[model samples]
Target chain A: MAALALPILALGALTACGAEEETGTPASDTTRTLKVGYISGTSLGPAFVADALGCYRDEGLTIEFEPIKNPADAIAFLATDKLDAYVGSPSAGMFNQVAKGAELKMVASLGSVNTPEGEAAPSGLFGAKSIKSVEELKGKRVALLGSVGSATSYLLGKSLEAGGLSFGDVELVTLGSSDMVPALKNGGVEAALLFAPETQKAIDQDVAHALVDSKKAYGSSTTAGIIFGTKLLKTERATGVSFLKANACAAKRFEGDWRKDAEIVKMLADFMKVPENTISGGGLYAFDSSLAINEGTLTEMQEMFVKVEGILTYTDLLPADKLVDDTLRAEAVGAA
Target chain B: MSPVTRDQEAVESTGTWRTIAPGPAELDPRGYARRRTLMERGLAILVPVALISLWQLLAGAGVLESNYFPPPSDIAASWADLLASGVYQESVLASLSRIVSGYLLGTSCAVALGMVIGSVRLLRVALEPTISALYTVPKLAILPLLLLIFGLGETSKILLVALTCFFVVLINTIDAVSSVSPRYHDVGRSCGASRWSTLVHITLPAALPQTLTGMRIASGLAVIVIVGAEFVAADAGLGFLVWNSWNLGVPEHMYVGIVSISLIGVIVGLVLRGVEWLLTPWNR
Candidate 1:
């Protein structure tokens, strides 16, 4: 029995090793699964919309929306086997990852601030009662989230520059944007970059007030969008194209007067686990109508990453065209 | 001391000395007074070199992906670049300062409280169960709460480290004290030694080995808690460097951070071991 057990155990180990991620066509080919990691915040509205409206199902693609606590985590897993796609900004973090040869491809536009059709950018510079505007942040501590090479810092920095103050002017504190509300309340940080429900939560709690919206300085920006890992983009692009089509449909439905729709409001409220009334009110993120990944905005983002953050040298800059593939978006739009 | 006495002392060594081993391979070779053999030294260097060479080989052969797992050469280059920039030194200094301060405070408080608890039946009965229960709770769970209480500055990081260290030291110290044997106490009483004298001379000496082991454990915990806390919220630390590097897809820089943390653990462990050698010479 002991001699016989070795081969059996080896077979079992081989089977376990073979049980990797889903690849090739499934036995049931009708429903192709795309594991998309996204934050629960409003920035990832289109994915939520697609999941709710059954757009993914309609296109024969099952988008498993892995609601990541922080979208920043998805960036790390974007190139690996863990995640297929993620909704996040074109920050230095993402750019550097691509430069490092993480097989991540920018596929679709989630939305940006420029064409804030029905959605308005939910994130803004919030601060305690003492600070009122960007100018007041000079010499005061300001908490920024999304890591060191974050676009939020650039947004804040640009705004500060307009007021004759640079990044060095303020004492920068690093903390999660979600935790910033309570931090502001208890005076952990003087100012913070908060988004969506957390911002509303702070405002309702009467501890923090909106100081400056980044859109004013950065202008209508393509904050984040859908990105594909090397595996799906290389082997299963048909599924990738289908996933983008679903996003486009979701974006169109969301752009077509979603604020007034009680169903969408309730869906978003339940999805976000916030008060139903919070969805009905303002402070919702405006997604782009076309769901188009703009090359210019990405270049602008890369430039800021290089000049503002010094994350990458000018020589290391991978052009926006190389980073993004417009063919998938073009196909998705045509199919939609 | 006489040569005879010296030989006897060497025979009954505490093992603190890294004396050369007598084996078939090294029996013929001349041994250093108290040093590892060339064979040992060669093996020591060989393992890591072989592993790293294999890593580089796999990477060059396309078996190991350089995207996630970088080559040692790349890691070395990044490590050198970072150190040359001076930020590495500043971050290491900041983290080390926090770790030392927190470990000292936590261990000191634990030793005091543990001694009292072990000495008094009432204190032990009242507090021991509660402490043991609290020790099982994950220290990371209280990080956000610590932030709320202590704010997002260095205070929260220090407090979290101290909190984690407190449990390990307290539990070990209590166990060490309780296990020192009641016979020692009885002997002290017969000798007409005062309670303080009994504790200081007899019980404390008996418990020193266990307590030092606790300190060593607490030292490692301090490194872990500080790194984790820094990863959650820190602008300057090896953890921050690793995290930011990982996010930015710089494998070389990430590996540098990885190496730095391992180096911290090694240095801290060696320091604790050296302290133990001083405090508990016989046990060594």
Candidate 2:
């Protein structure tokens, strides 16, 4: 008798769920929890600021930050609707996914290397003191955070290009950013493309010196940005806009050397579990308050990756429209 | 009926009745053995084929996402592509080179040291505990130090494989040598055998089976350790192939690397079994 009742109950529950789907009712904003993937550190400055300042709560959303070791994992999760949003660099992985018809997009630029004309960009190629120029890198090992398909690899190629060399000329070593400075010091690699505080560490330790500023090589460029998955892109776009609004609200705080702000520094330091000095000492990554996507830079990145054989599945470039949706960012910025 | 009656008469003569089943050898032994071997081979092939068919079905029906969980056919295509491109061949050769070099180096050193330590009481008492403690430490944990010491090259990865295989083979070799039968040693001594002669004829032969067993286990460990080390530290190898493909958002390529590694493991296991058979005749 109980077993018979159980099937009937289950049928009734499933019917109720089906009816809810049939009605096509929208979910409440307050009830929404956005799962955002992130790689920890200053790249996610705005998200951290947004979380700390309760911007997400104010916008009636709970932001669940999931730490990811690689952007590719986030891309996979995003395509499957496991992650609603992610903050990471634009990589060959993202482009390859788009080529494969995954419905994920770079909705907003998180940060860019917008260094002043005279100053060296904090993110660039740093090499051993004895070998001063990119030409010296010929036949020498140069490390990057990822392989030939990595975004940093593009930067390395550009730096190499300036010296009239190509990736084929040098041995490419894959090392984490933390390992870069040490590798340079210990001669594991002759040079490495390092980002801040690592770049700072290299200079301070007298191990390696900046050889090429990324700004001079590529001009003002978006290094990392926010991505939206199918769930946010098609199903619950309002929540996506709300997420961007919270992020944009926090981006206002990132204006003009945000590292100087004591509260921001403290919040970020606590969130990243690092000393306050580390936050203040590192070079600033610029975040646009409007949450704009640099279509030009995205084009450049795609072109660069497409040129490299076997890095991307498809050779043809994906138009900017397919890779990004500007409506969510526009809505978020308009609301602000 | 006639066989039952005859068996009953035999049982009555013996004053007891017992039912005994005939062994496979008694019931057409050659055919039985052939059937068993055929069944084993059939199941081995059938299970994986069934799994892959199920996977392809699910992927086709959209139960599994094609991008992340690519169909087996797609994986095969990607594997072929990699092969044609020379990436798969390069990766396999790299990993094989590391595994072979490290496995040979580690086992040779371990066996020599283990024999010496096992023979001398002072060395055994002084060193066994320390070696045991070191063995308990995770071999991969020292990879960072190896990288620091040896730099990020083939040396660190090769050494990591060696280190992992070393401990496993060392402990087993020590145990095998130390546990050789006392009667065998006495036989050699009573025959007026020299120390070297006893070691060669009596102790080594006694320990060879266990030592080979250790080597067999170390071969698998060598493959595992090298793959793991390659994931972090290498630009080429099966492990790197999997990692780089994933990084490149080519899941099919990643699957190819994974399948290749698994195939290598199976092949290595069979080769080791052959080695054990050749080395230990008495065990057979």
Candidate 3:
């Protein structure tokens, strides 16, 4: 028993020493606030740019990021009006909520796929050395962003169609895109549905190779977007418009050889806590200065999700135009 | 002796335990006792019935957003839908299998280690602090690291479940074993019991009640962690069903998963109580 004392004390010391918050809280004022729920990722580059540049502040809006960890939380918060806006994936849940007569609207694009210039979707299914071809993915485990039959799943389904396989052909594991690199290295999965920065980083490391480009399947797509809850639409239309305008300007700033501008890159780097190199040319979530929602892509994704979740019939489907409010987008487009 | 101490004694003794009746003024008159108990039981069930009815009414009246806050009828329809698709069966099987396997694995190791340490005071003091500290760290925080080591398969989830169950079982086992009256050890020795016999017949039975209590608590904790584990990387389970349904924006299916877990907790807890009743008949 006496011999046991030392080890226990030592172990206590070890676990107790390093437990604390890793990042500091953001500063905000009580006057004129907009709470935007978003996940932490490079996909939010436009918002990050707007946030860092004080664009919202210029318009007398204090931005509060809700920092959503799960996609579901975003939906609930938006539905309950706890969030004014949320940037996230276009899932069946978002569409179904609209169909059920929730006043939430897709206000502006959050992230999009390849452009007319031929840059494929920056995210895709990537394979290990052992997985040389799409055909080889059969029966192998794959990591995907979000959940099954999501945007990531749609991409996987496309590749599977080409490879004579299906979503059921391989074992699918749900993991975040950030976890994909280590997941790939540790054989957590044989392949992963990777998005930008991570996809580029993986390829640069030569650990995983692209198997299917989502951009190749759904060319000119809006993957996720900034959604305005009814509370914001009704109570603070100007704030919502201001949010889009700020983001549009940020998009233009990013679009304008902002990569070469040291101060802007440094500001983004400091705020996002990434190396300037990673953020500078970060093909993060390629956003057009227009901040426009892809009308057709939303309709296509909605139809696909309605069938996939098995909750809705084809007859229950509506066109994407019903869900998006072009009011703020037009304002941002003209003003920015 | 006071009524409370009498009940306590009955619980600890080999004699059959009986609950003491309240004094004359405390309960209803003799003639009305049966009716009183009936009224009490009915009242106990009334709250839940009323609440559920109100929830249903509010939802049907569109007081609640059916899209996010789905009605009970919609949730029931979802349960039927899940059953029709066989997703319900698969998810239940996956969750139950994981919970049972992890709880057993965790509790066994904890009980064995707890016995060794609890019997020795210095070991208890030395280890308990570390155990307490580790327990305070949220289990999900380490899941990514676990995924790195064990990958995103069943192994990582099972390991997390085990880890979650371990601390609760360990701390309880320590307390239970330490609480065993020294007089019981004296009695075992007087019977010419071997060291092993003293531990098995005397030490173990003395700690059995609390150990069972710990197991009950750990099982609940195991369910929570299993759901959390599934939330991270699993493709199938009640947790996966809830998370996937929520992500898909099907509130009814999410409610189905939530209700299923609540039922499982009640069922498992009742089963544990039944096991205790059967095993400790002398303690009533």
Q: Which candidate has the highest DockQ of all?
A: 2
Interface RMSD of 3: 2.5
Off by over 4 Å in 2: A1-29, A116-120, B1-27
- Model 2, docking class: medium
Residue A98 shift from truth in candidate 2, angstroms: 1.4
Ranking by DockQ: 2, 3, 1
Q: How does chain B of model 3 score on TM-score?
A: 0.86
lDDT of 3 at A57: 76
What DockQ results for candidate 1? 0.33
Q: How close to the true structure is residue A148 of candidate 2, measured as C-alpha lDDT?
A: 82
Residue-level lDDT tens digits of model 1 in A1-336: 989999989975553343222345644456777778876655567778788888888977777767776555777777666898887665666777677666677787775554354444566677799887778888888888765466566666656655677666788888776688877877878888776667778889999887765567657556578777877677766677778888887787677446677887877778878887777774655666467776776776666556644366335568776678888788778867
- How do the residues B210-284 of candidate 2 rate in per-residue lDDT, one tens digit apiece? 988888899988888888888888988999989989988999999998888888888988998998898778999
Model 3, span A1-336: residue lDDT tens: 878998988865542332111111122332367788886655567786687788877765688887787766787789888888887766666776777777778888865655435554567778987898888988998888776646567666666655677666888877777888878877768988777688887888889998765666656667667888886676667567778888887777655345577876787777677898886666634658888777776776665555454634234667666678888889767866
- Candidate 3: the clashing residue pairs are A93-B248, A93-B249, A110-A225, A121-A215
Interface RMSD, one decimal, each candidate: 2.5, 1.0, 2.5
Per-residue CA lDDT of model 3 for B55-124, tens digit only, reads 9999899898777777888889879989999999999999999898888899999989888888899999
Worst 10-residue lDDT window, candidate 3 chain A: A18-27
- Candidate 3: count the clashes: 4
The TM-scores, one per candidate, come to 0.84, 0.92, 0.82
Off by over 4 Å in 3: A1-33, A51-62, A115-121, A155-166, A213-215, A231-242, A270-273, A307-316, B1-33, B120-130, B134-137
